[model samples]
Target chain A: MRLSKLIAFAAALLLWSGAARAQQVSVIKFPELQKRLSRQNDTTYVVNFWATWCAPCVKELPAFDQLSTTYAGKKVKVLLVSMDYASQLDKKVKPFVLRRELKSEVVLLNETDPNTYLEKVDPKWSGALPFTMIWNGKKSKRATFEREFTPAELTAEIKKFLL
Target chain B: MKKLLSFFPALLALVLLSNFVDGPAGYQVGDKVTDFKLKNVDGKTVSLADNKAAKGYIVVFTCNTCPYAKAYESRIIELHQKYAPQGYPVVAINPNDPAVAPGDSFADMKARAASKKYPFPYLQDETQQVARTYGATRTPHLYVVTRRGSDFVVSYIGAIDDNSEDAKQVKTRYVEQAMTDILAGKPAATSSTKAIGCTIKWKKA
Candidate 1:
């Protein structure tokens, strides 16, 4: 009886630790993000810029999550870049991510002062939440959408890069 | 081959439709603004021409539903209190279609203004033409239109300041600086900026 109780507690600890580890969010600067986009690799990247406070951004996250799941084996990467202030990482961002159990990789964009960095992210972007961009370094082509995407619309956009 | 051919027409139609949706880039920094008469929350029509004694206007596109707009509400009020005497009164407008964003309905706007005790004219852009004409992309977007002879030319376009989340941590006051520059008989140093905010919920086509 004593052994079984100890083993159950150990298993619970492992599960708790694993779940906690999965909820950790990386905070990165714009240069670091730019570095990933500038890579000469063949992988296609679907990057979505969103925020927890943005109602539309939150509403559209599930579509991105679904895309990430369906394209798991493909040479595609789905990145959800959180525009929530770095100060809210512990308070809001992490809690929201954990609650959603988001399958896509999520990170906090640490850069502030949108005037200086907005154009750098993408000239087409007008600094709005729920923006999406798909790029392939090998293809040397990218498409930007400064609006929310439906699941079907997102899949169609990603399908072009897959071809 | 047949499947790929089917996609081309859809793609072409999308391109053409987007052109219609985007319309035009209404006002640039130096372009003179045409006056607009929008209904204020008090059930009275207000126009830029009505402010006869003012030198210019600080026009802000804001909505009650957006967090960014809510965060800047107090600062917006403070700006009107300070700048109205300086001959630059703030005119706040809600461009969101209430059907799309129920919280931005005229009744909700009236409640918000009354509860906040806003000292400025809070107007409703029922058709959203004013917002589109001004090329406003997000909530809390601002345009600094100063008097140039008899015309009101846009002097600055963009964010109210560098920081949108916290006003206390702000380093540069973009709108305040613009007002000071125009007041001192010079053009603004930084006439434009960019800040992230909720996308304007346009009425469905």
Candidate 2:
């Protein structure tokens, strides 16, 4: 019984670690992001730009997570794009995501030149953190917010396009 | 009655059009920036007019608590050291509301400036009017102003460089290039750039 309990504890530990490891962030360039943005799909995309060190960005992350859970199996997708330094992917970004147990899909934006990429994302964006973009390819509708959003506000924004 | 009803829709449309026509608030490149008198960390009031020998100013909106501001602190110090002698002194400003971000309070600003041994005047924009006027949305935002007669005209507005994380890997020094071009009586090759940074903590409305 003692041996069985120890084995169960070890198995649980391994599974927990595996779950944490699965949250590793993928580095993506602007072209890939553009392709994702331009893809013809019925799914509405909620792409949030954020960073580990940004206090407001971190504070609003749970809203994104809630959004992901609430919209699961629906036509809405939440993508949390980390603007943290690509060099700190392993040291900072990955660890923070794991620590927070972020449920939303997180990717580290690998593009260096903001002058070009900032316009690519949205012409009006001043490259500020905690910015969010919502778009529906099916309906040909899009919206962008350059500030933090509550879960309800995020839900309402995404719902507008999804409907 | 029918004619009056049709005019109501047009009146509503006019109101909406007026809101859009107002346009985005704050200054753009080539706009004239107003001088501000703000308290420095050294407990003295400083202004652009105080620097009598200065040809221009490198106005940087930075604060004490932001990680991006901390990362660029040394670089900002170096910018002051290099440019102050060249008649373009750096003027650092903390625009974040101390009430919203206590770490950015005046006391904290003094401590950080002292510890870093900052050569430039670290001023606090208590009213945050300067930041709003400059359209500075993030910490460590750079605005290069050139003096024309007595007034200052904004020449460049944006990031310090292409890379804020690694100085060694920086390919283009946007601020430096702009200042050098201005010094040589040439237009800045690159007037504006953007970088990811912490949003300024504004006071609660």
Candidate 3:
């Protein structure tokens, strides 16, 4: 009877910790994001640019979420970079990220002047959300779609790089 | 038949090569548009080359799904109602890729037109080439042109107005203000403003 109570207590602790970890969507500094990218060698980095208010961005988010889970055990990392306003980090961004139950690393991109960072992130990007970049240390493949994508379509792209 | 089928791959290759040779994407001011053939809601083809009454045209890259575009829809219609008879007709183009935004499909477009009763031509950019030609960055992005002698000159390229939200708080009616100047044969007071709206969904390069 004592062992059963101990097991239940441990389970509750595990669940609480998991929930806490999932809720933390902090404003990831640019340097930290770059460092994380550089540190992870031999792993494919799928970074998706998105915003909370953008309809298409919200629509296509599930596909990215599915992609992250499907490739979790592999040498793949999915980073969902929210470009929502810095002020919205708490009121909107974190709640949305949490509600979506995002499996990947979620970060509120800490940048103000889009003119400064748009090209820096990817020269081809026109500051469009739903933009995605696939990087594997050596080369970065960038794609900007002004529209939403199905999970299958997103999976196809991932498969190409995985191979 | 077998020989013809075997050459299909080569034929496809040639077509792809020619598409690249059409020169770079985008159009600039002062460019004369000789044609404006497009389908209407009732499935009727309309063209600018046939309209002799038009002194110029207002080509706007807009969509039904975008809130920004929807907000400006009434204003676009007003422009058409106010200026079309005076020789400036507004032409709204849906430049979004249907694959990305399925609601932008022709069927949805027809439904939207019927529902809203748009006064202007809401044409579909089948291959999105026309949108690329204009270098449109977002929905509700406007490009105004007027016929100068025999050519079309860009009068304005930017926002519908200064304010995206709160029409009551509008300070500058950039598009309308430009139209007024163009109608009077005077140079536009402000020729450009910051472009805003959902980004144009260009195909993956």
Candidate 4:
């Protein structure tokens, strides 16, 4: 009985460690972000650039959560790309993502320079956060809201792009 | 003659529209920066051309208001203190129109300078022409220029570091790293960074 209990405890430890490691958010490198943008088959990718410090971003996050749920099992993929500092991965980002129960895949951008990556993401981008981009199979359409956006406003944009 | 006249107008419009499409106002890396004489917190006139004798100048467009700008104030101060004597004096300019952002007015700017005990020139761009020339669209926007012979070439552009709140949490120090490489006459590995900040309040058309 003692041996069996020890084995069970060891298995539990292994499972816990595996879960913890998986919970670690990977900072998306520029090339990887590009690949992710391009490699999608039939799914539409909706990427929203946001930061934890941004009040508007925080406010609009729930709407994105709802959108992700609404599009469940569909070809639509919602990607919440946090432009927050990479150090916030464990300290703030992951916790926020977990607390909000974010359904979409979350990525904190790893690349440093925006001038190089901004144009790569979309030529029309002015490096504005709270920026939303929708990539259909053919072309990627982007909209930058200089101010905060509402759920309805975001949905309207998605509708326009998805069509 | 009619066809030529019509084609000329179309060509002219296309050229003008193309200029608008491309960012013509913003200063690019390695472009010469034109110096401007502006009033400082101490009510003294400071000009980049006058300080052209230095190896380079760190020109930052920051304001009294804006949380992101406030977060960077200490880092800016540290930057000025660390590299001012080393031929890279920081020249801070307030780019926001007072009518739009009252906190960025000269009076508030003076108060901010006094409260922060800023060591660099916290100048006021009253006409905001200098801000337009540099395409300064936000507070805490930075442009680092180096004197390449007689010309002032921009060495770096973007945020001071990755994190605005905690310096320790910064994954990338764009300005610091750029200045270090620039001081050594080497190319900056990364030249720019982008972050959302309060927009510069421009005068209404």
Could you give the candidate ranking by lDDT, starting with the highest? 1, 2, 4, 3
- The order by descending TM-score is 2, 1, 4, 3
Interface RMSD of each: 1.0, 1.1, 5.0, 3.9
Candidate 2's residue-wise lDDT over B36-112, tens digit each? 99999989999898877889999999999888888889999999899889888899999999988889999999999
Clashing residue pairs in all predictions, respectively, total 0, 0, 2, 0
Distance from true position, residue B52, model 1, in Å?
1.4
* Native-referenced DockQ of model 4: 0.15
User: What is the per-residue lDDT of model 3 for residues B69-187, given as tens digits with 9 covering 90 to 100?
Assistant: 88778888888998898898998888888777787888889999889998887888777777776767778778887876666767777777755544676677878888888888887
- Which residue pairs clash in candidate 4? none
Candidate 4 lDDT at B88 equals 92
3 versus 4: better TM-score goes to:
4
The superposed Cα distance between candidate 1 and the true structure at residue B198, in angstroms, equals: 0.8
CA lDDT of every candidate: 0.88, 0.86, 0.73, 0.77
Q: In model 1, where do residues sit more than 4 Å from their true spots? A: A1-22, B1-23
Give the DockQ (C-alpha) for candidate 2: 0.60
Per-residue error (Å), model 2, residue B78: 1.4
Better of 1 and 4 by lDDT: 1
DockQ of each model against the real complex? 0.64, 0.60, 0.16, 0.15
lDDT tens digits by residue: candidate 4, A1-163: 9999999999999988756643556698888888887754566677777777655578888887687667666667777788776867888999988787676667888755565577677764555446676667654454444444688887787777566
Instruction: Summing lDDT over every window of 10 consecutive residues in candidate 1 chain A, give the lowest-scoring window.
Output: A16-25
- Better by lDDT, candidate 3 or 2: 2
